[model samples]
Target chain A: MPETIAAVSPAGLAPEAEVYTRAFARVAVERTDHEPSRIGTLRKAAIDRFGELGFPNRKLEEWRSTDVRAIATTTFSFEPSAELVSEADCARFRYDNTHELVFVNGAFRSDLSRLQELPDGVIISSLEQGWREHPELIEPHLGRHAKFDNHAFVALNTALHENGVFVFFPRNAVVETPIHILHLGRGGDSPVASFPRNLFVAEENSQGRIIEQFATAGDTDTGGNHFTCPVTEVVLAQNAVVDHYKLQRESTDAFHMATFQIYLGRSSNFSSHSISWGGGLVRNDVNAVLGGEGCEATLNGLYMVGGTQLVDNHMRVDHVAPHCDSHELFKGVLEGHARAVFNGRIFVHKGAQKTDAKQTNRNLLLSPTALVHSNPQLEIFADDVRCTHGSTVGRLDELGIFYLRSRGIGEEAARSLLTYAFCADIVQRIKDKSVRRDLEEFLFRRLPQGDVVRQAV
Target chain B: MSLLEIKNLHVGVKDAKILKGVDLTVNRGEVHAIMGPNGSGKSTLALVLAGRDTYEITEGEILYKGEDLLEVAPEERAREGLFLAFQYPVEIPGVSNVYFLKAALNAIRKHRGQEELDAMDFLTYVREKMALVKMDETLLNRPVNEGFSGGEKKRNEIFHMAVLDPVLAVLDETDSGLDIDALKIVADGVNSLRSEERAFIIITHYQRLLNYIVPDVVHVLLDGKIVRTGGKELALELEEKGYSWLEGEVHEEAVAHA
Candidate 1:
């Protein structure tokens, strides 16, 4: 266990910390009868840890470039339910023929969820219900994969999370259709905050795909300021394969942070796609651990930020066993006064020989005011490791633009075509045709000059 | 009127002059070959005619279809049916060949007040042009010229010209890196595209390409000026004697004029 700072009183903490302390106190008193339960005990330990460490500051090396001081000092009250969200607002993100699980304000809404004709050996339910019905499967993997001792937001989420999605794929079960979990944040009359927690477990020889998306309601005038902290834990057994995609489309005034912890067993394959397009201040922490030999992991991310938004993606792939391979590519397009940061780390342990790792981070700034900080690092304790990392920050390719224009494409349309081409490789990597098409349309709609290219082409 | 005309055109790059005084005229239904040693401004003239912004037109005028061509933008020039097969074709990594050609075709068609072709019609048209250059069908789905071999890139340029069907096609050393087979294919494609309404300006250092696509007229360029103009026999003469004979003639002429 990592050492924790001394716990301080509510008055001595920051405003946001005080709010969390008060919220945890109320929840702790309400569940006094269930104090002896395992979840209750975990919650108490997590709240205690949160009180000890408060919120991470820029003093820590990991938090040096990404300062959460503004988020930590803002006072936001916990809202168990939001009243303004409608079914229409959620319909825009729905796909065809998939199991849909919806959560509003961090609370499960069975009326808004659709789960029909699931295959055998598959369980899809809310976390609270999963714990009640399938404790044997949920208890062993819930908080075990995601360690909260060193992460303040994870600890905070573990303590205050009300309900989120729970997925379990038993041995040898292959899910053909994807499972979509939509977490909608709707602000009420006052500033609100919610902690969403997810647990995913795939047994041996199982294959599955999961899409976890977060968004806000359409009306901005009624939606007050809010903060969202989510934590997801994934455990893959031997020979299991899973593809997980997370799309964050929060409101412009919202502060969102999420931590995803993934563990891969022997010969398991896991791929993660993290696409972020909204939120005023957003941070994503994705860490994968290859616990067995011959495990393969691929991480890809694309962030499009404009206005005053700030987005950060911090990823780590740990190779603990030999013959494990990991590939990561994270790209960003920043405009206006927006800023972005990508820090990718790969670690090969002492016995993790024959480890092959490649990491790349590229950023395209559309404006002079936009900025990006990309750092790709590798730490190899083994001798026979093939590791490579690179990063680039620049504008659109001028020659490519000229080449397009010389073909009779307008100047603005040429710029848009080149920018879309820059992002085409990452989009082409998605296996699902429908999802890839939808994402392509969504990204193209956000471009400043995509309209012209769309009309001409 | 001549289809294209250049009257005492003087162009420069920054401070140095590239083309001192170049005068040329090409009528419809004719093929003109410009033969010169390296750095004789053959490629520069092609770039300037295609409206590349790198070179400044210090003095003189260029007339395309009896209009002031210098006042037009690069894309406008392209829309006006001026095509330049680049000396070094650019490799665009993510724009597919089919999509790029379709976009360019539609833009030019719209400028010419013609209806745009649908996907089916466009593919049909493109497939026909692709066959003319003997190009593989798989190359159409790939990004523009990306990962193509030297010969493939040159073939792709001629393939594009075949699809666009430009009125004035400028071939700038199209045979530089091509093998004999590829050079034959390119020449055949250019030959098939020739018509009474179209013309070509084939710029080359080697006279070997002229053997395949015989030129109606050949101009020998020296020191940014057309030193001599003759019939197709001049290309065969230059091929046998090399550029040294022409260089000696130009030196003698300059000495006698002085």
Candidate 2:
């Protein structure tokens, strides 16, 4: 790569995107990874779209509260690595009984990954191997759910994605245990950006759980100065039941932009938990479409941030058919100059009657300096639908604190206890016992008087 | 020494003054009743005594156990055996009632240089206090005061008063929203907790609560000042005859002074 290509913004694109444009051309010529020919056309279109849309600015209504100048201007390597960087200690985050898939620096590590004996009709492997072995299986649903026509980050991720995870469950396969994906971002001497992608396809009547945990190696507090752009697409066939959880615990200084696109068929019950507790500048776009009748979609998110961190969650639920239901509950807590934004919209398409949809977004500011912009919008084109949306932004309940303090608890303990209670609204909704327990343990460590909170709740 | 003393106490919120030039004294084992009309600062006095930060004490001093009570923090005040039964108990979701009381009790005990109670021991101790208020066992595991009926919130306040065992417990309009049956039950809860080592400063808008638990002294507060003081019969007189008569006498006194 020439130094001139990295220094200047090429043809009005951002300098950050310019580096990727030059790097993409080189990677495209010398690529050795295996994928279907359809992906090649998808990547070309995505790169062209990336050149056009560069990066989002505050002028856009969706990106007003969140500023992306640092992500657009900073130069990070788009490297493809075969050697493992850090020791990637992931023992503390493991669930008791489940298959594990490991990805280090956006590159799949088969030596570090594990899988149990699969029941028939279940497929789990790296997308690289999955495409190499069975391109037919990867062709139909590869870029189906999440298209990058309008989203720049999605386009950028689509153009430069490394081998991520590929999961397939044939019709009527009921697996008891969850599949855990641990993506670790380790700090090197210089900053690097990685685009990690995952594709999940479940056939009719299948039931299972999936957990995605993105974290820094060793859980260190500093030197995570990297960028991760990940896009995940999930397709659930009719009558498929799936519970998904995404825990984003990147390093405190890491930049993370993620997009989750999910589509549901008739009578499919899908629930997702999105938890973001770490990262410097983080933005997540979670979009779910109930495209078939009698589909139920539940989306719950919790974002707890402090210390000048900024987290933004953009959610959209589209009821595309009659008798479809969607429920969304998103909560955030911020302190110490931290800022958070929650923009949730429930769209009821024409003739989508009996489209029972509910959306709630609440934010708690622990410090006066912290701020939040909660926008919950509803767009209904149907005449007879039950759709409601509400949002609230407030500090910890002062009167409640006064009541607790008057009863002999210290003011600090009371505040921590109340904050825990506020977060429990979404935490308790997680159906998996092991996942919920790990989340509780992770949350308790961050709050003071942890023992009291452990006992009180 | 007196259990609590307030000399020429002047309290205010913002620029509006409340509890103007109020002086009072209470000894151990004495139950003093403060009866007043609406906006007469009965609730204000209770909150100020409990060290609520919303109120500013611009004049005079408060002494408890011969120490400056106003100098202590709210939690420190609670640990030093000061309790105020809130007029409107707060509903705190996700904090169970049993766990909240245990935490409160443990904090106070730690301040007294005593060891913390284990879960079983705390449960046993709290059950005894709950029985005094006739509280249902089901309410123990529910979030603190959340979705509680008006009567239940009042009983929970007294239940807390019994468990914390404060040296000076101020009941701030605890009988305002209770029915006749709930009022008697609350009064009985207060009566059972009375002893020689503790005192009660019961503030009420009506004297009906005084019938169940007779006060050692009754004081009528009007327009931010205690205008009259008497024995238990004063409550009876005010119950039969309304506060308008007392307001008349206060107006005459003010005119004479002017």
Candidate 3:
């Protein structure tokens, strides 16, 4: 692929950037009826921002370790194979008694989705449908928290995201069942690309849980390369409690880049678990902002990768209010020649006194060749705040292995048991029982003695 | 034939030799107590018997059930009915104790051409064995030895012994950190497991534990060699005189040979 510096502008642009720029124009012209809508203005501004920023190069501070040039120069067509998906393909991803909303190649599939009659104030639908039906509810919080002024990927997703899930609950609307949004990537004979946007809004005093997962639907290996770029935004009002889970297990031949942003109101409690069984190349940014006083946030993550896969997780938590507490725990387990990066930053503002924040990142390398880069940073401007951060990257516990081997477990089985044991604490922390079981299933699926582990654990 | 035979055994770590020219023999249905000071090689002998590879055996031959014990791997040694109750039991987080024991017992049973025990049978088996040490049922569901008290850890090792039912059991300082009551409980647990098919080598720093479970033979080890061998009365003698007297005797023997 040639770096076709499109003479469309003074500055040189890569093939993908140029292609997306042209695609954005065609989309803008096709939506002539949307000229007077706020979405039109948002898209226009996002496109302009994408044009200026282009795709991030290695020179940028954040993208220094993760190289995106492989996908940046390759030309990707927006039209992908809409592989015939049935209820069977979606069944494997469903947990017990969840309101599932399925998407195929970034297109909403109501046929595979199931949502029972919810309470009067709760709204869960496709963004395309929600925008058309409940514009009053979708207008205010769509692009408010996830700003796209400097982030090129977020800007591109904001401009071109076709469809995604929209979950909204008004004040005090309690939902008993979990809302699951499942995204399945379908590859074709050529490199295919899609942008999925998700928005979640929880009003005052509401309680709920959400599980957003990404996986491949059709022929994952034989099919050509698939690029999935997604951006998700969640807003929680005062006194609401929510538990969110994101499990990303894309095909190894695919590229997954995502941005998950969350906003919390006064005294609201929110927790998110981001599990990455990474694709070939993945860069996931999970950021949370505490905007009100007395709020609590728990952001935990686990990433396991093998082969030559590269997974980078960048996390940021902002303590903007007084009497707020935030906890971040991210762990990685790498095997083969896989490499992973973990960057956790906790930022406390000047006036945010009485802030309590903790961050920890641990990595276990199963093979001698595997590599991990872990960095946990704290930037506190408040005097009365308590903050601590720690990181570790090393091999599995040798004594633990010897203990098991001496107990009649073979060496291989001992390692597998200990490997799964390393992930058990995080799995046990999942508040949703079914989701925890599902995570357990995924964690053990790749292990050698999975049945033995399941039986033993 | 002896259940275990160690001839001219020497074990060392790095440049330091922990055991030198040690010779011992054990028969079935008998309990042997090995008494020594802190720096003696009692634990080294126990660990080497369990096939821990950290210690280098420069010149030694250990025969267990007429097979070269050094050639077998640790797990194979366990499967062949050899057990070691570690002085400091290893704490493994996230693996339940019940599951660990069941996997171990099934492995042993399978090696002996027996079928694996299902969960129901295993639970029944475990509850019956728990009574040997007065173990709490709640500890069975917790991680193996993690967050367990010192006494609980020792009792857990004995519980493992009862479940595994090994042919030769080596206890390494099981009574080091236990109170008198806990000591009696562990001794009772060990005594109840003694049968014609089983043998034991109990390593201890104190003679108080021997009061509860009297050994048929007592060996005094000094400077990596078994310097004295006697009946259970030797434990009472060591308790009355302490190890300094034994050291003085060995020193006088060395001087006389010189």
Best by DockQ: 3
Model 3 Cα lDDT, one tens digit per residue, A81-136: 55556777677887768889998878788888899889888999998888877888
Per-residue alpha-carbon lDDT of candidate 2 for residues A15-99, written as tens digits (9 for 90 to 100)? 6677778877876535535766678788888988777776776766767898888888787776745364433476666666788
Tell me how far the alpha carbon of residue A253 in candidate 1 is from the true structure, in angstroms, after superposition.
2.6
* Candidate 3 pairs with clashing backbones: none
lDDT of 1 at B253: 92
Cα DockQ of the candidate 2 complex: 0.68
| Model 3 Cα shift for residue A387 (angstroms) | 0.8
Clashes of 2: 0
TM-score for each candidate, following the candidate numbering:
0.94, 0.95, 0.96
- In candidate 2, position B127 carries an lDDT of 90
Of the candidates numbered 1 and 3, which has the greater DockQ value? Answer: 3
Report the TM-score of chain B alone for all candidates. Answer: 0.98, 0.98, 0.98
Better of 2 and 3 by DockQ: 3
- Interface RMSD, all candidates in order, equals 2.3, 1.1, 1.2
